[model samples]
Target: MDAITQNLDLFWNGFLRSLTICLWGGVGSLVLGTFIATCRVAPVAPLRTFGTAWVTVIRNCPLSVLLFMFAFGLPEIGINAEYYYFGLAALIIYTSAFVCEGLRAGINSVSAGQAEAARAIGLTFTQTLTQIVLPQAFRTSIPPVGSVIIAMFKNSAVVGAFGVGLDLYSVGESLTSAQGFAALPVLTGVAIGYLMITLPAGVGLGVLERKVAIAR
Candidate 1:
């Protein structure tokens, strides 16, 4: 109790930074991933090829490598931004691959007969995808997409490695060293803090999944 009261400000700062990263990263990834998934399944050969290559390459890369690339490598190429934005970009780009795959799997789960029927009605590729496929894909995608968002929220801690001064990992380190708190207690607090974000997200996604569940 005493320790928590003393560290409330640190905890609050960490929480806010983490939330910012997750919020932007989650939205960016979802939008990009959906686009990539659509392209991957597109009728056009070139679009499908490009999407396959992107998912294959990005999905295989280690996330830490991607973050380090954005953090240190970008400035060498004359694309500089605040370290925080670089971290946010890394989270979005890396997580977007997983998001792409999750959505692709959901899109695949959609019945082929439905797509055929849509096409039979003279629907173009975009129309069939948007009007018929993506809605169902999104609903079927809830569990995996939820997992990706939760993973992104936790991954925001990695930004601290690049000297983002106020992220959860940095704040936790500050508490242990500067404030003289023991490591275990500080780490435990950090873990609980992450759970406070992720657990609710999981529960809420579960409810949404149930509500929109596709009839098998």
Candidate 2:
């Protein structure tokens, strides 16, 4: 209580920063992941290979390594940016692989006959995917996609460790190390801050899942 009250501004700013990262990262990952999933299931052999390689390499790589590369290595090639953007990029890139896999599973659940029918009727691959397959695939994939997003939100804590910004983890670190506060209270506050974001998101996803199920 004392630690949090004394440093309200720090906590507030940290909370906002974490939220911002999650928001941008979530949208970026979903869009990129969807495109990758589409490519993975496309008629073109080269696209399928590219998508496969992307998911394979990225899924095998550690998130921390990606963050290190983005945070430190990018500057060597003169593609410098703020640490915040670098961290967000890492988060999106890392999470998008998982998102791609989840969506690909959903896309696979769609029947092959439907795609064959669409082609027989002169529907292009793009039309077949966007109009028929992806809509159903998204519905089928809500739960897994929601889980990925939740994990990404929690993972955002690591960003501050790479000096991305003064996020919740950094706030706790500052209070405990620099400000001489007890670690317990400072960490508790930080956990609560994360819960504030994740809890509502989890509940909202639950409601969405139920609604989607009902619609089906």
Best by TM-score: 1
Per-residue lDDT over 1-216 for candidate 2, one digit per residue giving the tens place of the 0 to 100 score: 899889889999999988888889999999999899889988999999999999999999999999999978999999989988999999999999999999988878888887899899999989997988778888879988999999998999988877775888889988898889999989999999999988998999999888876243
Candidate 2, lDDT over the whole model: 0.90
Clashes of 2: 0
- Computed on alpha carbons, the lDDT of every model, listed in order, comes to 0.87, 0.90
Kindly report the root-mean-square deviation of model 2 from the true structure over all alpha carbons.
2.4
Question: How good is model 1 by TM-score?
Answer: 0.90
**Model 1 steric clash pairs:** none
Model 2 steric clash pairs: none
Q: Count the backbone clashes (under 3 Å) in each candidate.
A: 0, 0
Model 1 residue runs over 4 Å out of place are: 118-130
